[model samples]
Target: MRAKKIYWWLVFSLSALPSLYFGLIYFLNPRQLGIDPVEVLLAESGQWAFRFLLITLLCSPLRRLKLRFLSRYRRMLGLFSFYYASLHAVIYVVAWIELDWPIFIQDLVSRPFIYVGMFAWLVLLVLAATSPKAVVRALKKRWVILHRLIYVAALAVMVHLWMQTRGAIGEVLLYGCVLFLLLAERLYRAVPLLNHQSVGKSANN
Candidate 1:
């Protein structure tokens, strides 16, 4: 079952390759799409960014629901989230900024919100690189700590989406609600009652 889940994830992602292909082609030649190719790319990638972000969060909740196999592939889904985010950043730079390095640098410096997005991406790069088993074992003590950075990543993504499109507050609010609920669930599960019960059991032993 777990193997099939992973297989289907690959299949699903493969199905989306056409979008990436056209996105790239349209990027190289803006005249391909009758509509604004850049807008289409941005919208599609942004939707994907949020979708993957939600999936990453859903890993835990789905596991709580006894869908245990999901945990096996959380890292893969997370890396995909970062993948779409990177593409979103590329679209912003290549399509919107038109590869004007100096102007882009200036914009990054001037725009407060871009910092939010960039910081998230930086953390994501670290997370994606360290997703392997060897690194996780090597960083045993630090592994869990490092992965907790995903909360910050999620926040950064929300801010990125909120700021990038001025009127997309509805979508932003929806993501915000989901994130808040997920974090709250974690907190609830970590309550003193559960901790105390565990401690008492350990002491009795």
Candidate 2:
């Protein structure tokens, strides 16, 4: 099982290598893309971040189905989500705004979408920082409470993506639909009937 988990991470990391390679190409040769290079970077980073957010959300649903032991990789997926979000923010600041203080402040205050994205990233930061087993042990009950921030973070991420997309929101709507279904699944399975069945199985074991 441990070997299989390591292999999965390797696969994801290898697949992500292309993104890094493209980023470098954009850095060394901005004219490669017809659009602004910074815009390209931002779009890519944001896309991957959302993809990872969805991946993290899938862990629980997959677990319920008794699919492979995905819970072990939840922290990895979560940290990757945070990593891409940070990259997105950095590109926005360094490439887009050139780290302009006044403009940064203005956007943060005036742009509701930016605010939501920023809040989501902040929550991811806290979660990623405290994901260590030692911290989880020390925090005990509080760990569970803090982890609830994932729900809020997911909402913020979806809203951010929805706001960023221009006309014909088909892609955004599709992602929204999937996540909505995921949440519904979680709720339906939370019923006492399902809980009783689960408890019964545990007792039998």
Per-residue lDDT of 1-205 in model 1, one digit per residue for the tens?
A: 8979777678467635746786778858867764687877877776686677677778877877888665656777777777887887898888888999998888779886787878888888888999898998898757777887888888887887788767557877887898888878776866864656553322100
Q: Which residue pairs in model 2 clash with each other? A: none
What TM-score do all the candidates reach, one by one? 0.81, 0.86
Please report, as a residue range, the 10-residue window in candidate 2 with the lowest summed lDDT: 196-205
lDDT value for candidate 2?
0.81
Model 2 per-residue lDDT tens digits across residues 1-205: 8989787878568647747776778778877854677787888898888888888888777876787565657888888888889999888889888999899999999998888999999999999999999998999777877887888888899999998788879989888997898778766765755657653332100
Model 2's C-alpha root-mean-square deviation from the true structure amounts to 3.7
The lDDT per prediction is 0.75, 0.81
Indicate the residue-level lDDT of 31 in model 2: 74
In model 1, the clashing pairs are none
